[model samples]
Each structure stands twice: as structure tokens, then as C-alpha cells.
Target: MGHINNKYYLGFEGEPEIIFTVVQKNNEKSEISIWSGYFNNIMQQITPVEGKWTALAYYYNLNIGWYDESPWLVDNIEDAYKQFKSIDKYKLDDLEEEILEEILELFKKSIEENNNVYISYE
Candidate 1:
């Protein structure tokens, strides 16, 4: 059988409860989705319109969609936040915006608690 990557990752917020992503953690399961191709397609479309984010690698660092069964594991959550704070939310479609918001939220909690929240998929 050929290998198929069934799972991809999205980061989320801190609840001291979830085994979250490498860059961050979570409050709900729905917050952590497995979208192997969705981010590539959606982000590609959204990036150009949002120009501020089109070139930032750390922004992509928040979305580990390209890495199957691996976590992002960022060393500095605050730096990520500073770089990402300017992302224009209105440019994104509802779901995409929601995902960005969750990523930011997770970054905040991780920064506050000084802990790393990482996730992986099967």
C-alpha cells in the first residue's frame, strides 16, 4: 500500500489540559484539525490579499499543515506573536480567520505560562 498522510496540524490555546502543538496548545479538539492540503490552498489564496503575511515563515510556523505527524516546536512564542500581530483578520474567510485567532490565542497562553504545547497526528 502507498503511504497516505491522513493528518496535518493546527495550533491552539492553553488550558493546562491539552497536549498541544510545539509552538502552542489547546482548549478544544475541533480547534486542532487535520488538514493536510487545506492550509496550502487557503493560505496561498489569503496571503496575497493580506500582503503583510505573504513572506513570513514564522506565520507558516503556526500552521504545521505540511508536516505529517510532526509538531512545530517553536523556541520563542513571543517573537512569533510580535511578527504575527499585524495580520489583517478581515482579509481571511471566516474559517481561516478563526484558525489564525486560535493560533494567536495559543501563543498568548504559551508565553504567559512559559510552557510549550505541542501536537502530532497519526
Candidate 2:
């Protein structure tokens, strides 16, 4: 018999803040290469049901097809939020106004720099 092994930790927002890695077991043992810190602090602590947030990653890889179509990509914390709102149409009212403003500011900077930022849902 084989089993799937996974481990994660909770963040201040009470969500799975980190996904350590996924391991599969079989007769022929093998390990999958997972990049740690793939989704660190990328997501805001907003509930999908009430806060207009969606459980989706907001950032797309430029290296991937179709994403390259958009020359300007959000590559920072703030811009990522904007992109999230654009797609989800949810407001971060539950969060402090100062935090929201800071995120927005970071997003603007990322947009200006043409950086690609992404967020994962809890």
C-alpha cells in the first residue's frame, strides 16, 4: 500500500500559509522536486466568501504561453492585489486601511517595474 504525505503550517490569518511539499510513495520510490517558498506572503488574509476574494493564484508565469501576451505584468505585492481585485471584484475592507494602502502602493511599484507577482489562496 502507498500513501500521500503532505504537511503545512497555519499563518496568522488561520490559513495554510505554507505547503511544504507533496510526496508520493510506490514500489519504485522517487521524490518530486518542489520549490519551497513558492507561495510566501503572496496572499492577503481575506475570506473568499465574504471579502470578495477568490481561491485562485493571481500571478501567471511570463515564461508560459498566453501570459506573454500582456507586456505589463504585476511583479510586486501591491500590483498583485490590484490584479486580484480585477479578477475577483472583491474589496479588502476587512483588512486595515493602512495595510490595503501599502499593498496598493507596492502593486503600483511592481507594475512600473514590470515585475510578475503572484498570490495563492489559503
TM-score to true structure, per model:
0.50, 0.30
How many residue-pair clashes does candidate 2 contain?
6
Candidate 2 residue pairs in backbone clash: 74-117, 75-115, 75-116, 75-117, 78-107, 79-107
Cα error, candidate 1, residue 104 (Å): 0.9
Task: Compare the candidates by TM-score and give the number of the best one.
Answer: 1
Best by lDDT: 1
| lDDT string, candidate 2, 24-88, tens digits | 22232211111123232223433344545322333222123113332232233453454544432
Give lDDT per model, in order: 0.47, 0.33
lDDT of 2 at 27: 34
Superposed by TM-score, candidate 1 places the C-alpha of residue 115 at a distance from the truth, in angstroms, of 1.4
What tens digits encode model 1's per-residue C-alpha lDDT throughout 30-113?
234535343443334433335454333434545443243345355555766654465676766776666666667766776896
